[model samples]
Target: MQEFALIMAGILLAGAPLVLATLGETITEKAGVINLSLDGTMLLAAMASFALASATGSAWTGALGGMAVGAAVASVLGLTNIYLGQSQLAVGFILTLLTRDLAYFLGHSYSRQPGPSLGYWGIPGLSETPLLDLLLGRQSPVVSISLAAIALCWWWMYKTNAGMRLRAVGESPRAAFGRGIRVRFSRLMACLAGGALVGLAGAAYSLAVKPGWGRPQGCEGAGWIALAIVIFGGWHPVRAAIGAYFFAALQVSGIYLQDIFPSIPAQVFQVAPFPMMIVTLLAVNLGRVGFVQDLMRRYPFLKRFSGSWPITAPAALGQDFDPKKGL
Candidate 1:
């Protein structure tokens, strides 16, 4: 039981960065923008945050710096696509390459260098408890913040007027503009905010989850995984967080499996989670197939069990919006 608790805690800690990045993209897409620069943004942010933290000797400062880097990258993507009329895919792809190379170039000095990192801070009362300690008591602040972000985003999206306007912009910018919402501004803000979260995720990676700056970074493909989770989660914060945790569990399982079967090459365990996640994504989308649709229709109750039943992208996603053209 103690081992199980410890494993669950590990999943939560490992999954925190993913949760933040996925939620960040969810917000960006919910506002009718696709920031394909996430992979690069995370890499750059990770390097920047670690460098800043090492220089300043303050983890919080590093975190904020990382967020700034993320927001800056996002701004470029949002502005070029939204205002300059550049294709979002093109801009995002280019930025990914740019930021990635930039990180590698600039981060050479910090490779494998020791730096201050976030330490465990257990909740006072809960830290002493038996199973609870293993599960939630002894975690870094980043994990707590990641969990909180899930609820905060969900509330903001469903219960706030600003969020409504943002959703309006995503669903139909022309209609939203008719309703007096500032479509471009809302999308831009969402991009910036989402990018910040992605940056924070990067900071968390270096300062807490993986700890330290180096080549390979150990988080290379995390941004892509976060992107897939957003689609699998149907753009809902809670569902998306669940997807992050599920992936994290797969990762934890791989580690344990290595111990159980020593004959299996370690590389197999390390790479297994990625392909497994891709397969799960494919399975989730199977609901879109005709036979599956027919099966769901035959037994409507099945819809309740299938979270992907109504999953879809925002109506205006990846499309440019120009206020000057006006509805």
Candidate 2:
């Protein structure tokens, strides 16, 4: 039982970044902005946060700096795409490459160096509890923040008027504008906010989960996994978080399996999650194909799962919002 608890905690720790990043993207897409620069943004933020933290010897300050970097990148993407009438996809893709290379170049000095890790602060009584102790006792503040983000985002999106406006802008900007909502401004804000969250995720990686900076570039493909999780989760915060945890569990399982079967190469386990995610991604879209649709129809029981297999994306995602079209 203790071992199981430890494994679950490990999964949560490893999955925190994914949870935060996926939720951030969900918020961005919900507000009608698609930021494809997630991978690069995270990498850059990780390096920047590590450097800042090392310089100041303060984790919180470093996290704030990371958020600023993320928000700045996101703001540029949002403004250029929304106000300047550029293609969001093109701009995002370009920014991804640019930010990634920039991180490598600028972070040359900070790479592979030791820095301060985030401090763990468990709740008083909760930290001493049975299973909870193992689960939450030694967790960093970022883990709690990530979990809280999920709940807060879920509430803000489903239960608030401001959230409704956010959805309105994404789903039908023309209608939202007609209703007197500032569609462009709303989307711009969403992108900035989402980027901040993504930045926090990056910082969490270096300062807590993975620790230290540089070589191995462990965080490289995390952004892509988070994005895939958003799709698998149907853009819902809770569902997306669940997907993140599942993926993390898969990763953990791979590592454990390698120890049990020494004959199997360690690289196989390390790379297993990528292909698994790809297969899951394909499964999510299977509803769109004819054969899968036919199978779903023939096997009534399959409908329980298949009906929601391919979740529909937000109506206006990835499109440039034209003011003239709305007016």
Question: Which candidate gets the maximum lDDT versus the true structure?
Answer: 1
Provide TM-scores for the models. 0.96, 0.96
lDDT tens digits, residue span 194-292, model 2? 999899888888888888788656789898888899999988888999899889999999988988999988999999999998898887877878987
lDDT, residue 78, model 1: 88
Q: Given candidate 2, what's the lDDT at residue 259? A: 84
Q: lDDT score of model 1?
A: 0.92
Which whole-number lDDT from 0 to 100 does residue 227 have in model 1? 91
Compared with the true structure, what per-residue lDDT tens digits does model 1 show for residues 207-229?
Answer: 99988999899779898899999
The alpha-carbon lDDT assigned to residue 150 of candidate 2 equals 90
Per-model root-mean-square deviation over C-alphas: 1.5, 1.5
| Model 1 stretches astray by more than 4 angstroms | 294-309
The CA lDDT at 85 in model 1 is 91
